[model samples]
Target chain A: MQLSARNQIRGKIKTITLGSIMAEVQVELPDGQQIVSAITRNSVETLQLHENDPVIVIIKSTEVMLGKQA
Target chain B: MQLSARNQIRGKIKTITLGSIMAEVQVELPDGQQIVSAITRNSVETLQLHENDPVIVIIKSTEVMLGKQA
Candidate 1:
């Protein structure tokens, strides 16, 4: 699913999914790191994502709901 | 804020920020719309975001904390 929008979140893909279509990534910064929780697989195919691939992660601030992992 | 990761979320930028560096976007899908709430500006510049630009939004499932907007 290709989208033409303007909200891009760029970061290094610290990790990829283990079994299912999922992965963990961290956004590098001059100060610190903004580690995000999940990255979907379908998105990978749509975005043609790969390891070490310079990619952008867009987040609607409102969509950024705070929670703790189990 | 440029990042080389593998988790890319693709979607359309429904709206941009009014005053502050903020915006609201909607991701199109085969079934329904996954209306996420917020998109940050720094992430935008990092990815060189522009209007109608195809971009990816990376979300750590853990980071996806569910909540209501006030």
Candidate 2:
């Protein structure tokens, strides 16, 4: 399936923290940089994700904000 | 103002294409890499953005998705 979201970063799941409704999944890149993602717990279950799993970080352009320095 | 977005990239506004309701904004980084953002025209007007303006690209964690390789 085609994705409209333009930004895609490859990384490995470093950790998964589940909350009541949301889940925080940390993805560590090969370069050692980490990104945190907060997704629905249901989506996490649907994805069957676990630590050390390879995944792509998908971010939609519509959700992106352009901020100017104040 | 404080932002909840976890991912922020420093860039400059490269272009802006406005539609009836939405607008596509292209931000160019120092190394010449570009990121595209689809934002509401209302936000574009609120920001008073123009080409070549310095801006930061913001992506929130909750909106981020993890895509597993098939």
Candidate 3:
């Protein structure tokens, strides 16, 4: 599927921690870079996400901040 | 600075498109994955972002969605 946000990285599910209303999903890339995403528990159940499952994390925000090293 | 968001990808600024109030910045990773971020012009100026500058794209949202291939 085509996403407008443009940042698409292939990662495997490393772990999933569920809370009452939200769930945290950790995705690990081939380079060992891990990206953690906090989403709704409903979405987690809807996506059927589990450990080692391949996923594409979709991030779209109007406030993508930039940082520089000092 | 420490951010609560977990998705921090190292990328270089590819391009910057300025609008009246918002700016669209394209960041390219080493693997050629391009991430497009729409932020405020004020932030773009505050961050002093420019083309070819190293940056960390910070994405924080309560709505990080997931997708799968059919």
Who wins the DockQ comparison? 3
Q: Per TM-score, what order, best first?
A: 3, 2, 1
- Every candidate's DockQ is 0.08, 0.56, 0.64
Q: State the fraction of real interface contacts model 3 keeps.
A: 0.70
User: What digit string (tens of lDDT, one per residue) describes model 3 on residues A1-70?
Assistant: 5777556667789999999999988887766767788888888898788999999877775646677776
Per-residue CA lDDT of model 3 for B1-70, tens digit only, reads: 6888767778899999999899999988766767788888888888888899999877774545666665
- Index of the highest-lDDT prediction: 2
Per-candidate TM-scores read 0.37, 0.72, 0.87
Q: After superposition, how far is residue B35 of candidate 2 from its true place, in Å?
A: 3.2
The positional error of residue A54 in candidate 1, measured at the CA in angstroms, is 1.9
lDDT of 2 by residue, B1-70 (tens): 8776776767889899999999999987665656789999998999999999999888888878899977
User: Between prediction 1 and prediction 2, which has the larger DockQ?
Assistant: 2
Model 1: TM-score, first chain:
0.50
True contacts kept of each: 0.00, 0.81, 0.70
- Tens digits of lDDT, candidate 1, B19-63: 257645555433446645465555445555555555466544545
